[model samples]
Each structure stands twice: as C-alpha cells, then as structure tokens.
Target: MLYVLVKTKKGTLVGNYSSDKAGCILGRSSSSLVPMAGRKVADEHAHLEERTDGLYVIDGGHRAGTLVNNVRVKEYGPINKDDVIAISDYRLQFRFVRIGNNEEDSFSKRASILPVKSVEEPSPVNNEKMTRWREKIRRSLVSYMDLRRVNVADMDDDALRIFTAEAIDRIIQDHEDIDSEIDKDELARQVLAEAVGLGPLEPLLADDDISEVMVNARDEIFYEKAGRLNKSEVTFTDDAAVISAIERIVSPLGRRIDESSPMVDARLKDGSRVNAVIPPLALKGPNITIRKFMKERLTADHLIKFGSLNKSMVSFLELAVAQRKNILISGGTGSGKTTLLNVLSNFIPDNERIVTVEDAAELKLYQPNLVALEARPPNQEGKGAVHIRDLVKNCLRMRPDRIVVGECRGGEALDMLQAMNTGHEGSLTTVHANTPRDCISRLEVLVLMSGMDLPVQAIREQISSAIDLIVQQSRFSCGTRKVTSITEVNGLEGGIIQLSEIYRYSQRGYDKEGRVRGDFGATGNIPDFVEELRSRHIEVDMNLFGGAQESEAIQDGF
Candidate 1:
C-alpha cells in the first residue's frame, strides 16, 4: 500500500491507496484535481478511485478549470509534496510516499474510505443576527458601567463598593438572567475592571499612532506614540492579573509561559513584537512590552520627507548600492537602524536575487527577487532550532546577489563578514554601537565569539576591507531619530582602521519648539567613490558639500 496525504488550508488527512485503482482517487467535485487527459471530466459525482503507486485519473467536469492556484496540471504524474491538486474551484494539496512494512497494516485500517463532502456553508441571516446581538450587548454593558466614577488612582472602600454595585448592574444587563444566590457584585467588578479598561490603557492600545506598549509591573504602564514614550493611567489590581494577561496574550499564538518558562518572546497577528518576563527573571513582578509595526511600511520617500536624509545623501547611498558597496549601519537601540536598512535596501535593483536574514522577520523589502529567512527558537525539547549563524552560512550557498542581515548581535557577525569578504558584495547589516570606533571594537568582540582565535588586528583588517561605509544613527532627547554621521572606511593605517567623515550632522542649537535643529553636510573631503561616480558620468555638486552658504540652508533640514 502507498501512503498518501491530502492537505487543505483547514487541516491534513492521511490515507492509503490500493493497487487496483491505479494510485489515483477522486475527491469532492469542489476539490482541486485534474484528469490525466488534461480535460475537465464531465461527471460531477463520479466515484473514481486511485490504485497503489500507479497513476489514476481524475474526473474534473465542472465550470471552473481544475487548477492549483491557477496553474493547470496536464498529466497523470506522481504527485510531489506541496503540489496543489485542483478538481474544480476548490483546492487540495497532495503528498505520496511509500508505507513502511511495519506500519502498512495499521495504515490500511486507518485509511478513509468514505467520499469527501462539500464544505458546509453558514447562514448569512444567522450570522447577521449574532453580530447585531453582540453589538447590542456591548453597548448595553458600556452604558450600565460608570466609567467616570471608577478612579484607578484612589479607590477606597466606599468607592470600591459603589463601583462593584455598578459593575453588577452592567453584568445583569449583559445576561438574559442571573443567579441571585451567587456573588454577582464581586464577579461583576472583576469583569468590569477588565472590560472598561478603567484608565488610559485601552485607548492607548487602540490608538494606531502608538508603536510600543510597556508595563513596568502592576503599578505603571507606559506606551510610546510617535516615537515618544508617554505614561498611561493603567494599573493592574495585582501581579497575578498582570501575569494572567501575559498568558492570554501568548496563548493564542501557541506559546506558553509559567513557572517552567517565566519568559517568552512572541508576535501578534498584526506583526507586533511582544516580550514578557515573570517573577524571578523580573524582580518587580510580571512585565510585558509590545512593539508594533506600522500598517504601511516606511518608504524611502517617507524618510526623505521626515528630513532623515538630504538629496546628496540619498543620491550617494543609491550610487553606493549600485556599485556593490558593503554598508554597515551602526546605532544604539531604538535608533531606527532597521528602518534605515530597509530604506537603503530599496536602492537595490529588482532583478538581482536578495536574501534577508533576521532574528525576527521585521524588514519589509519591496523587491520581487527577495528571499526572507528568519531564525527559529528551540522547541520545548530544545531541538530543531535554527540560529542566525546557521542561516548566515546557509545563505552563502543559496546563490544570492546580495545578502542582508537584519541586525548582527552574536557570532553571526563573523559569518556575515566572511560572506562579504568572499563574494557577497553590496551586503548590508546593522550593529549595536554608540560610536564608529566602538562599532569596530564590537565587531572584533563578536568575531571572537565565533570561537576563532584570530588576532584582533586580523578581525579589524577584515572589517576595514569588507565594509565600505558605516552609517551612525542617533535618537535625540526629543525622541527624534536621525542619521548623525555617515563615514567611509578608507582601509587601515598603522594598525588602526582609517575612516573619513563623508557626512556629519552639525548641531545648531534647537528650534523655537525645542526640537533638534542640525545641518547635515559633507566635511569638504570628497569620498574615494567620487572618481568612480565621475567615471559613471554622474555629476558632483560641490556646493552641496558646503562650498556655498546658500547650500548650507538647503542641507539644514536634513
């Protein structure tokens, strides 16, 4: 017997085919399957079956062509794994393999012999009624609860009693009937506290402008909006409630956190990053942090509009990308390093194959020829985990034109540098560092983490040769993230890597609104790539490099 597995979006089904049916079988007419003759079979309810290990025919005679996501299968060939078989408009995936001798008997007994049925359809009228009922209940509950009276800051005994009574009334309104014998007031208070979100917390989470949510235990909850961190009037009744909330947030994602695992890093359906740590790991009680990505990705044009870069900086970076310069973006945490990397990646031509490796899949590149790879955490048994170092080494064999490392925090930096030095030009990566000099030292330390005993000078030499540019970003006190410096490495001299400041941000005090005002301009030193740009017939604007006073005004905004 041949073990055959069928998969749909809902779930997977396993079965076996006998030798008599030519290893082919018919599913519901709604399924995605095609006949060997490359024609639609006319009989909608024909019960054609498959034989063991032999090709069988599919009778797909329907209005919709038998195609897998639109590709028409024209032959009765062996089905490969992940091959979508389309019988009509409905689709199914097929995987066929040999059944082991020891498991053949059990597999035959477990094979599903019944014909597949069409998917059940729900009644639209019933669904509409349910939605209306839910809306009505929500409105009634909201009205019965006194949101204005419940103050999270100072809830004395008298205030608690009044709040609890109001909560009970709201709960009674939500339900058709309630048991009088139960402690309805206590239960109501608990439910109301959760639903009303009695403070600024719920509004903060609902606000699309907020990018991050942070809770420092049960007493304080902070949120970041428009890159500025603001304290919310949210508080948990106790540490237990905070832990419970964390559990609920991670539970839907098939993640877990308890005494056995007091910490978890997870993501929500909306691509928001979440991190939670309970007691022992977190001394101040359970804490949760959420970083939300924008609904629309940040584009290069958006960066320019935000005064992150001037025309010269943009043009120079674009040319550097086209010329296959390996660039490194250095910055402290939350300095928009990944954001800058994403914008720079847009300069890459769409025709070249690009591979992106990251701890989390955060970078959103627009190129068509892109392969995104994310690192996986270890399973419960601590097995089957794939690290960034593993992915960095694997990418070298993937025949990529450019390899982008989202951010290098570990030994993966060594592998990434090796890939850059070998043949992967135009590769881009980000590192956590306070300054350009510190970035080199960080690289040396990370390379040592790879278990290679190479001299520090050797690592520095590799970095100077492999990296063409280092772009440093900074987050100001006003929460404005900007590119502070763009330095070009010009090889090493006397055991020190030589770097020239191509573009520097000169702090010119602050504006009337107290926002940072700085001028981003060249330091009068032309880049080594100037000759290369001239060779390509690209004109140089010396005035943009601060040769003229009018040019300073033009570059001040960026």
Candidate 2:
C-alpha cells in the first residue's frame, strides 16, 4: 500500500491508495482522488500512476509544476519513500510500506519525521486549552479597548486591526508558560476574524467554489459548492461570536437586528446578499445566509458556456431586446433570475439611458448612462422607508430610455407595467414563478396588490399588452440554473393572456455525476417579433431558429 501525507493550513491530510491499482490522480478536479480545492492549485494539476516496477509521478504540465524535495521536476520520475512533494502552497510527504507490514508501526515512524501534527484527531485537553486561549484573547481585546479609549464606531478598520493584533500578542505573551502547542499565528488570525470579519465564515467566503454560506448557529455551519450543500468543519466559538459577527455585518449599514427587530437583509461591500435572523423570530440561535456575488460581470458568452442558454437563444434574446420588447424574467428564488436579466440588459444599445431599481442594488450594467436606485427600510420609529414601488414610479419621470426593476415582489409590478405600456418599450424586470404562464398570473396578482380596485380582466389586458416576452429561469435540484422557457406574449384572447413557447429546455435525465443533462432547443415556432426586427433593419439570422445542426453552424451569424 502507498499513500501521500499532505500538510495544509487547515490540518494534516492523509490520502491512501493500493499499489495494485492503476494510479490515483491528484488535482483540484472533482474527479481527482485527492482533490486540492485551493486557490493556488490548478484544475487538473498532477497525476500519480502505478507502473510495472514502482509507482511513478508525472507532472501534469501545470504552469506551476509540482516540486519533489525542493526541486522542480521536468518530467515523470520514480517515487521513493520519505520523499516530499510540493503542489501550490501545500507540502506533502510520501510513504510507501508493503501491504503485509504493520500499519501502526509505519505511521508512528513517519509521523515523527514531519513537523506537522499527525492525521489522528486532536485530544480533548488540547481542544479545551484552545478554547481557553480564544477567551483570553477576547478578554485582552476588551481591556485594550478600554485602555486606549477607543470607540468601535469611530475607529477605522486598519486602526481596529492594529489594536486587535497588539491585544492578541499581549495575550500570547501572558499565556506563554501555559502551552506551546497553540498555533499563535492562527490564534491571532481567529481573534482578528472574530473582531472585524464574519468569524468562521471568512475562510468559506474566500473560497470561490462555495456559492452559498449558511450559518445555522454558532457551532453549526454549512456551505453550498457546485450546487450541493456540505457540512463545513469551520464553526464559531460560541453564540456570542455569532451575534458579534452579525452585528459587524448590519451595523455599518445602519441596519439593526435584535429581540425587537430580529431579521434584516444586508449586503457585503462586494455585493454578496446577506440575510440574518436572530433570537425571538428565529428558533435557531442566530441564522445567517449569504449568497456570494460573482466579481466578474457575466455576459452572453459566459451564459452559453454554462449551458444556461445556447447561441440561438442568445441571438433571439439579443434581437428581442434590440427590437424594444419588454421582457419579464420569471423564476423562483436563487434561480439566477437577476443574472439572466443582467445578461439580457447588456443587449440593449449603449447609447440608451437605463434606470435600474432594486431592494439591494445588485445589477451591474455596463452602460454609461445608468441611474441606479435602491430601496430603504424604515427606521426604528417606522419612518423614512423608500420601497421598490416608489422608485419605480419616480424613475419614469427621469426620462429613462429603459426602466429595469430588479424584481417585482409587490405593488411595483403595476407601475412597471404602466411605464411599459406608455412609452418605456424596452423595460426589463423579474418575478417569482415557475413557468411563463404562471408569470402572467403572478403579475396579475401583483397588479391587484396595487390597491387599484380594477377589474381582473383589465389587469389581464394590461399585462398581455405590456409584456412581450417571459423568460423562465429555473434552478434544478442538481443546482444547475438554466433558462427553461422563453415564451412570447401573443396578447389576451378570450379575456386571458395567451403565450407561445419559442424555446424550451428538454431534460434528458441527470448525468452519472449528478449534473443536469439537458438541451436548449427551439420549439419551431417563428416568433412575431421577426417582422418587427426586419422592419428596424436588425439582422437576425433565420438559421439560428432552425434545428440543432443548422443552429450550430451559423449561431454566430447573428
């Protein structure tokens, strides 16, 4: 049997393999036997294959190639016992013991050779001492706060971090005689993290693969990566640590969460959406959910790469936007609704002025003339609340070339429809629903919520005339998000809005690895907007709407 022992910042990692097998690849790929999902590791970085004589290591042509015993290897080489390999920032020690040899004896012999801790779990006494050290660091921080006469509200982040580091150093000096097993750098990091960052969430948030971070309580944390939820080993020290982290998030934005008002929605500086619920309303201690925002603005090419939409779909959507069709993107929560809306909005002409309204202000439009408006929650006295409806109504008077409401969750849907009906032709918005037909019904319900006291038929007529297209975005159980349907609004018939599906996603069942297996195909229905597009001299290739091969050959001819 052969195995590799790697030392990470988190802990010691032990990956074992049988020498009789072919080989075990090592990289950040999910299929790799030992997946190193760190920022420094490449996608399919390196491989280890077993041969006739002995095991061999082959460099996977990584830009940052693998290292053996402090020297970079140019090609394949034989693996020897007690050899150290370095990949990215990680250092791994190799061990090869015959299958019949005593495993326990080999582990003890090898463990002593490395500076890192053994792969075995930490003792309870060590855990207890670490907890005590964390408390001493917190107490020292409090003492420093009092001695320096520092106000948390007034101090800048750099100043606060300096004080925190000094306090942690002092605590380390005071406890030097107690134990030397504690990683002082890590302890200081934890103290600073608890003070300024989101505590245990800092590392999870830094991981690019993790899309969602959920903190059920102080000690229980889970994160969603690649559309699957997994329990995270990271956790807060106590309930107080969780509460302190929540306060750090909402305090800067003037949002409050407590027994009086225990729920708030805030966003990080990088535009990641955050929702926190504490005590009273929340049965769990302190529940926090964070949806990470992508730093790069995704365009049509990116969506096509993700299989969210094909080139034909992109061409049709681009033409629809250029033809000034009002688009309503409908989907359930976390279904990539806003992302699709942003991509479609990019199809609009750069010369036009765009006004965007949102509760959290997440849209990143590249147009120069963009008027971004955000809603405000009322204060403790229940005053000064600016809602989506108010912003929608006011944006009309701003002479916007197009009005884009982030998501119509309330009465704002009425004002958005009216604006689209009057002069705003290329307006865009999103709604919560499962299908395109359900989106019209949802809009009717939202219009009724406007307190207009209008007839149901009147609202139906308004919706049918205003919305030209409904792009239904859906997030599958496997965590892949795609545009499930693109339906054209053919106006109201028999007092009900009529819809025709132009493109639909056909699911072929889940793949072996559990990823979504589907195809985006046209419904063979020629859209009514084709004539309008031709009238405006917008050259939309007809071959794009054809079958698979036809569409693929000239999908770039838009």
Candidate 3:
C-alpha cells in the first residue's frame, strides 16, 4: 500500500491508495484526492504515484511549485521514507508502511541487529564482574562532572592530570560502599577519561606509538600501533557517552552534530584529523575516527631513521623543489603522502610567499609569508557554504609564490592544476592513487569533475605541462611507509603523457619479524630536471644515484 500524509493549517491528512490507479492528485480543486485549501497550491498542483520500482512525486506545472529536501522537483523522481515533501507552506515527511501477510518479515528485515533467542545457551563471559565495576565508576564520574565547573582550557597537561586524580580520589573516598574491591588507580584513569579526555580513547591518543583510533560503537573500540590493529579492553558506557566525546571534540570548534547534520570532519587542537558519522546514516550508532598527528614535526632525517626513504631520495626531492618543478605526491590512504609533502615543503625558500588551502587545515608550514585558508560548511539554512574551489579561486588574488593544497579530492584539482600552469611553478599537492600512471589518470578524472567539458587531449596537455614530478608513496603490510617511486613527466607524446622513472623501490620480501624489507635505488635515468637544478646554481652529485653511495653521503650530511 502507498499513502500521502500532509500537515495543513486545518489538521493532518493521511490518505491511502494503491498502484492500480493512474495516480493520486494533490491540489485545491474538488476532484483532487487530498485537496489542500491554499492560494499557493494550483488547481492541479502535483501528482503522487507508486510503481513496482519506487514511489515518486511529480510537479504538475504549478506556479508555487513542489519541493523535496529543499530542492525544487524538476519533473518526477524516486522518493524514500523520511524524505521531506513540501507543498506550499506545509512540510510532510514521507513514510512507507507495508501491509499484508509478509509484514512481520518486512519489519524484521529492516532491523539492524537480530534479537537473541530466549532458549539459546550462554557462553562463558570474560571479565564480566570487572566490566560491571567500570560501568559504576563511569556513572559516578558522569554525576561528578555535572556538579563540577573546572576550567580545563586554562590548565596544562600535568595540571589537568593532577586535578583529575584529585577529583577521582574525592569521589571514591566519599562513596566507600560503591565497590571496595575496585582498583583506585584504575578508577582514577576512568574518571580522567570521562572528565578531561576522550573516554576510552585517552590512553591511545597519549601513546606516541598509536597512529589511529577507531570507535565502531559505544562498547567496541580499536587502535592501530606500528601498523597492527588491536582491540582494547576499554569501552564506553553507552551511545550517549560516545556522542558526548564527539561533542567535546567538535563543539569547541563551532561544529555541531545532531539529527539535522549527523556527519562532520574536524581536526583536534594538535592538528589530528577527525571524521565522525552518526545515525540514521550510520546503522551502528555514532562512529568516530581519529588520525593522530605527531607532537614534533618530522623531517628528512626522521624518514631516513625509520627506513621510509633513503638519503638519495630526500636529496633528489630537495633539488626538485629548489629547481621550481611542480611535484605531486601520489599514494593510497595512510601511506604518508601528507607527511612526505610536509618534508618536501620545507625546501621552499623562506622568503617566498606561500599559500595553503585545506579542508581541515592540517599543514604546519613555518614560512614567514605563509597564508592558510580552510573551507567552511554551510549554516542551518544551507547558505554561506565556502568550498575548496572557491578558496582556490580566491588564492589567485593573494600573490602566492607557491600554492600547496593539503589534498585534492574534487573539482578543486582543476583549479589547482590551472594555478600550477599559470606561473605558479613550484606548487605542491597530493592525490589518491596506487602508482605513478594511476596518478595521471586520477588527475584526468578530477579535471573532468570540473564540469568544463574540455577535450581529453587538452586536459592531458595541462597536466603534463604543469606537473614535472610524481612521487609515489606506499605503505607495506609490515606498517612501513616508503617512497616507492619518483617519475618525471616529460611532455606528451603520441597523445599519451610520457613518464621516465628516476627512482624506484624494490621489495626484498618480508623479514623474519614480518617487517617489509625494501631498498630505494635509482632507476639509472638521469632526470631532465637535473639540468634545471644546475641552471639554478644547485650542486649535483652523480655518484649519489649509486645504491652503495650511502657510505660517503653520511659524512656529507645527506
């Protein structure tokens, strides 16, 4: 069965119908099934119908018009449950309810989790008693938090930790009958987690070794350290607690999370990236993911120490930047593209003016003449939304010596490429791709996203002329991130972009402890960019390309 429900000035109207009829009419005329009495509604305003495929609402050439989800309906389109339908002044949410013999099964099919059978035998539970104690402590902490008004922003890390410890001690000492066997130290940590830090996520964030934290649900948490994921014993009390932590993170930044807007992308005060999604889009409840940033800026030497890349690669990259060659770092997710971008960005002359545009503002460039711009989401009215493309267009007026985008994910790639081709010679950015050739293909796709309808050959010409180098970064199964390849783009040939591999990473299989063993070696192709470096009076070491040249390079401070 199908129905049309609308809220009018008189009252609510719910009418049921079947697909057997041509369609149902909505208007102010007497012939309409659900006649709305309003001047804005035409005599034949709109038509509602249901097909085997889906339910749809079509506009009937009315003056006032029909709208769905704030966008005017051009003709007719498929509608789903909970979709907002507007007719003149009133707004109605669409709902579909199935009737007949299979209704019970339909309801069960829509359920997120299956119900536990009453006759099923229970398995042995691990740490059930300890979980109960933790829940009690969490409840107590929530209660204490309600009566407290501490200025957390004014305290340093040590002061905050001390205050948290004292508060937990007072709460436990005042309620001795709560649980005598509960460990006081453990209780202190839990209280600190709820009161000061993100619950069940504080320890992971504190540990420098941990790189990522993922919250699947209130009671299920996971962390990654050294490229390996491990489930933690810590858990939240409920979904509300998980939401509270997310609110604590994004609210301070003037971002909101609720039914109206349930998804958000934000960054921590320390520049760690955060992405969150809540119901009803996320069936599991609220999900929070945090990508922790380093406390200290990582440099070329740090990469060498971690075996991510050798000295020769860094030296070549430094020269590439110095020679004003546009560079694009390509890699899969979590492959250290941004990290390598940061390392290479340091080579930019301090006196040159630099402009960086990003969604979350994660880049920490230290140039004195640097300008950073971040995109902004719209307000409740769906107005004032500033996108990355808008910022890229505006940066052109700022007289930037070099433009660096945190990452290109959309049509902004077109503007970034245009900016690179139009005298912004030393621009830098990262794109998501697996290899160097894939990077070029991804660029072509992103250029098409601009909706310019240009010829493929024109876009290829723009890409090949603007980008001089593509640095491929990859993360191995052993959690190692390395610069796998660096290819030089040498103009277009036979309607295809020509690429010369200057450096390549060869994997020597995994080591005994499951670490990836790889060595960075030159492909023996002297890059054309070397001549550009020499023209700029930069010294060149031909022997640096030799794999065994690390012996003397260490003495030369490579």
Best by lDDT: 2
TM-score of each: 0.63, 0.75, 0.72
**Ranking according to TM-score, highest score first:** 2, 3, 1
Which tens-of-lDDT digit does each residue in 1-558 have in candidate 2?
Answer: 555555542332322222323366777776765536555577777777766666677788878888888788855556766677788756665555545767555654544322222222236666567667777788777887788887777655634554455666666677666578876756666666786667668767766567889999876789888888887654677888898888888888878887877888888877788999998777879899999877567788877877787888988898889989999999999999888888898898999999999998778888998889988888887798899999999998999999999899888999999999999999999999999988888998999898899999999989989999999999888888888889999998898788988888887776677776767788887788886777788676887667552212111100
Best by TM-score: 2
Q: Residue 462 CA error for candidate 1 (Å)?
A: 0.7
Computed on alpha carbons, the lDDT of every model, listed in order, comes to 0.65, 0.76, 0.75
Tell me the tens digit of each residue's lDDT in model 3 across 1-558. 444444432222221222224367777776775535556778888887776666678888887788888789855556765577787755554444445534433323222111110111112243344456556766776577667876667765434544555656666677677555555555555555665567667657766677889999877788888788887766776788788889989887777888888999898988899999999988998999998888778788888877777778888898789878899999999888888888899899998999999988788888899999998887777788889999999999999999999999999999999999998999999999999999999999998998899999999999999999999999877677888899999999999999998888787677677777756788788888787667888789976565452311111010
Find the 10 residues in a row with the least total lDDT in model 3. 112-121
Instruction: Give the alpha carbon lDDT tens digit for every residue of 209-285 in model 1.
Output: 66678998776788776556777533555676577667656776666787767888776555667789998889999
lDDT of 2 at 76: 51
Candidate structures ordered by lDDT, highest first: 2, 3, 1
Worst 10 residues of 2 by lDDT: 549-558
TM-score: which is higher, 2 or 3?
Answer: 2
Candidate 1, residue 105: how far the Cα is off, in Å: 70
Q: Over 4 Å off in model 1, which ranges?
A: 1-202, 226-228, 236-255, 536-558
